[model samples]
Target: MLGADFYMPTRVFFGENALQRGKEMLLKAGHHAFIVTGKSSAKKCGALDEVTTLLQEGGIPFTVFDGVTENPPLLTCFEAGAKAAACGADFVIGIGGGSPLDAAKAIAAFAANQGMAPMDIYDDAKRLCPTLPLFAIPTTAGTGSEVNPYSVLTLEGGMKKKTFKAPDSWPRAAFVDPRYAYTLPHGATVSCALDAFAHALESYLSPKSTVFSQTAAVFAAREIWDVLSAMPGEFDVEMRTRLALAATVAGMAISVTGTGFPHPLGYSLTLLDGVPHGRACAAFAADYITYNEKSDEGRALIAAFAAAIGTKPNVMKAFLPGVAEVDFSFTEAEIAERIELVAGAGNYQNSPYVISKEEMYAIYRAHFLKK
Candidate 1:
């Protein structure tokens, strides 16, 4: 009894010269655009230039806000929103990786609802305004922030990350030009790919997963595995394109099923230990698979995933360690504290089986506790 429930409204333009090919769709977002991005990736990747050229050619005015940082803060979104509103921007364009893309969603929300408090973005029940139309141009093959409605932001004065999700937050269009990622550094490329892999793996294993999402997840996971297994070699344009598509597919999968334990469990490592988001999430991937293997259905699912990626389950688990390098150690108390922080995460409920605090502590101990 295969069933599916999928909803993806963003029009995606993927492959070489995607931005140029999709320029007409991009221009339809709004006449006045508020471009949101981090400090450098957009310019380095040439996405900014291409977007500006397109906007200029279309006679659409735009304002660029390049202040977004890694694990973007709530205050940053609020500030950028104020700037966008001040400029009378009618739409928002997000350029760069997940950070800027996520920030753009918040900026759109804030810009649309002037004077809304920073925390108000998280409270959908209290929100009374619609978000500005959003367009995404991804400079990296990670986060797939271009397609999803989730905007993960750091709380003020804290390392904790929270997601702001609304139906209106989805980008109206996504330009996924693989050429934009050609300038990405080697480490970033690997990290981004790993993040996509985690998304697919988690989504496939989620209890909420449907036939549609599982099919997407398996395809994305297979594509990512192919790219990752060929690492330490040249990532030519073809390889980048495959990875980019995989990331986008993974994002679409998670949009339906949401992520499992790895995402929430990885947040502390990313924020506190300075591990890259993708690598941090992947650090727990093997263990997450193992944890689920405790159940019969879970074992079947893992086998299915392994078969889809053309590898044995154990072999796939072994391959993760080479890429997800988490060297830091934590005291038993610290491990317990970290587990406590994420114990209440909604992702746990999405898991195939109940995840007790004790089980979480054990997983943390296996990875982070001092021997």
Candidate 2:
């Protein structure tokens, strides 16, 4: 049994009217707020305007620092942190998609210090100081960044992305509302949904899973799968609740257990090919189980998860447009090139089973067929 220690410090306000309580939350935290956003869309969506009016009415001195990008970069984080400090923002608010929310976490940490950020994330142990108070306002129902403890950032000229975390990495509070994601683009919608699914699958199968984490992941997975199974529908409160809850639960699971090889491999697809995080992983779901779940118990658990989502045990068979075989079409040279990079990831060591580059390539080719 993985006698894991778990604790979530973020004060979460859930459901439909949660955003209405933002100003009250500000007063509780004691602050001048710095709002972090991805772009002008938050302003166009009137979300920025709405949050501003609320903070102003409550007399919370606030400023907006809006330049976060998809797959947030270290420079973006440093720039945002500088802006927050320059504005004297005592409390930080992230009011866009997961990128802004993740940016907020790093910005909060970096803002508390007064020095150049570490050029190498692996070497930047001193860059992450104790963070200022953070409020995560998730505009999208995926990535679950609002409720998690780690931030995934793209390093400058780095071959691989870096995951940042410490005891102080958790958000101080999270304000999640489904209404904000009602207008998400179709591709974004698919990508985010896929990201949530990876969280569930990874959390569920981790040898680090505890009874508490597994219970939470199972329910979250069910809800996320239901929402994805029936797409292009109006936002269901239940789905939003599940996404928020799943993100939080998965976040907790990762805090203790961490993730496996698919995540590192998925990064390659996202960075190199620009496949969104979630979809890239989904493309490999069937293969992930095949290569990693060598145990009968593991396969049974995966089959159960698929059945829960209305898919069969052999769901992976559908991914192959032609015949199924161990041989993949990717050049062996290409697979050999990334073998060490994927294997070297810290998270890959956390996987229950030992994985090699050949297995990783097999998993990738299995899901990437052009069918």
Candidate 3:
């Protein structure tokens, strides 16, 4: 039997011209909008320009804080929040990829409680203040931070990547214009699509998964897999649109069920090895599939999930290997050290089975260490 509860708060607008709805979401959010984004993608993609034009034409005042970087640090979030507070920003608009969108959520939380210390943001009890309303415009197809309340932040030291989730942290609305992602490079397209697929896969396999979440995950996974498999030459605008929808659907599923082992296991690869978040997670997924297939119960669940996505279990597992290779190399001892890091993550409990340290280390060594 599946879990009982399902909840997703963000009002999503998907497709080619979704940016047109931004003016309406902005008006409903507040008067002054603090736009949080990366240094370049937003401008290069023309999302920032379109949003700025909408705000100006609508007579809405706004400020742009473009300091958000890849794998956004907690200190950067604190600084961005301070900027929002100092400027009296009533609502926040997050543009670009997952980093900016996740930063926007944290910035909203921190801006509401400007008195709280940077580290204090992690203390759930201290997050009592109402977060500023957020409107998201995602330029990339991965991360799906627009629709989810959880904000994955790498703290100041960059050693720990943690999630800060609050009910109020969900974006009030999301404008997912795939047109903004039309020019995304080939590497990013593959990595991001795989990330969305990973989100759906992990959420479906999570012990907390509900029927509703599984439905969303299956649909999203099918879209991602099909689109990824059918890429002919260069990625066109239509491909971007499909990937965006897959990401959004996957985001909604993860919001309800959260992710399982791969995400927690993949974090060290990203933080330590400098692997991109999507590819790092991808590197662990093949091992995750193999591990799950070891038990009859796991095999049954995998079969159902595979059926939902229109494939056999063995074939699905075979396709995962391509997405699971990374460029980093480590020795046996180094791999063991990294395994310890994953053991500390709280998300381990969400895995369908009890994952022992030995099992976790084996998975790490098998996927990460070259033979």
Candidate 4:
């Protein structure tokens, strides 16, 4: 009796030269394009060059906003949106990892609805104005922002990261050329893979998971884990392709179930402790899986996930420490305060079981304090 409504509208073009499709999508979406990206990776990976060449060849006017940072701040979106509005750009092209892609969605919203306050990006109760059409070109294999409507924004003066989704915020198209990932650093590749795997793992264990979402999650978990386990060696084009596809599939899965504890609780570590977004989220994933598996209700779900990935339930734990470590130092009171934040998160209640404050604290302790 699996029942869930799934919404995925992004037209994905995945292959070695898939980016050539961006020219047509951009042309169809708008006359002028606003390209959003981070400072380095997009430029380093050659995605920027390829995309720009396509736009140029297509005779489409465009502008590049490369101010997006890791854990992108709301100000950056506001700034880029204002720029886009001023330039009369009709569409957005997000060309990087999750940060840029997420920021691009927010930028499109802000750009189109120039009259709305910046904080209104989080007003889920209000019907938001439609965003400019967006096209994503992912240079990294994680966060899956390319295919989802969620845009995770880090507010400058806020305690936790926030996300907003307008129906039109889903990217109109995505160019997932795994060859773009060939230039990724080893550590970044591993971290992104872990992030992708966490998405699959968390969503698969969600109480709201449907058969379709679970299938996508399981496939993503296996694909990400297998490629990640063989890293430090040069990645052939096929391996990179599979890894990128894994992240995208994971993103699609989470779009249906949303995320659970790891993502909500991981925000503090990422924002406050300067942990990488993927690594921070993954730090808590293993314990959460164990927590779920030990419960009567979650045992079947855990077994299903293990079978899908072709491994024991705890195999992820063995791989996690190799990807990222919990090295933060926090006092008991500070730890309690962080736990309170997790308790207040919207997605905290999305866990398969009701998470008591004590249990939440224990999960954090298992990852950080004990390590």
Candidate models: Cα lDDT each: 0.88, 0.69, 0.84, 0.83
lDDT of 4 by residue, 150-197 (tens): 999887775667788888899998899998899998777877888898
Q: Model 3: per-residue lDDT, tens digit, 124-201?
A: 788779999998999999888888998999987787788888879999999999988887888888888888988999
Q: Which candidate is the best by TM-score?
A: 1
Residue-level lDDT for 281 in candidate 1: 87
Which is the better candidate, 2 or 4, if ranked by TM-score?
4
In model 2, where do residues sit more than 4 Å from their true spots? 2-4, 120-129, 231-249, 307-311, 316-341, 365-371
Between candidates 1 and 3, the one scoring higher on lDDT is 1
Q: Give candidate 4's error at residue 156 in angstroms.
A: 2.4
Quality of model 1 by C-alpha lDDT? 0.88
lDDT of 1 by residue, 1-371 (tens): 54577899999998889888888877777779999989898998899999999999999999999999999999999989999999999999999999999999999999988878899888876678899999998999979888889999999876678899999999998999999999998889999999999999888888888898999999998998988887766688888999999999999999998888888889888877788989988888888888889889789899998998998888878787668877778998888777776778888877666688888888888877898
Q: What is the lDDT of candidate 4?
A: 0.83
Q: Order the candidate numbers by TM-score, best to worst.
A: 1, 3, 4, 2
What local lDDT does model 2 show for residue 119? 53
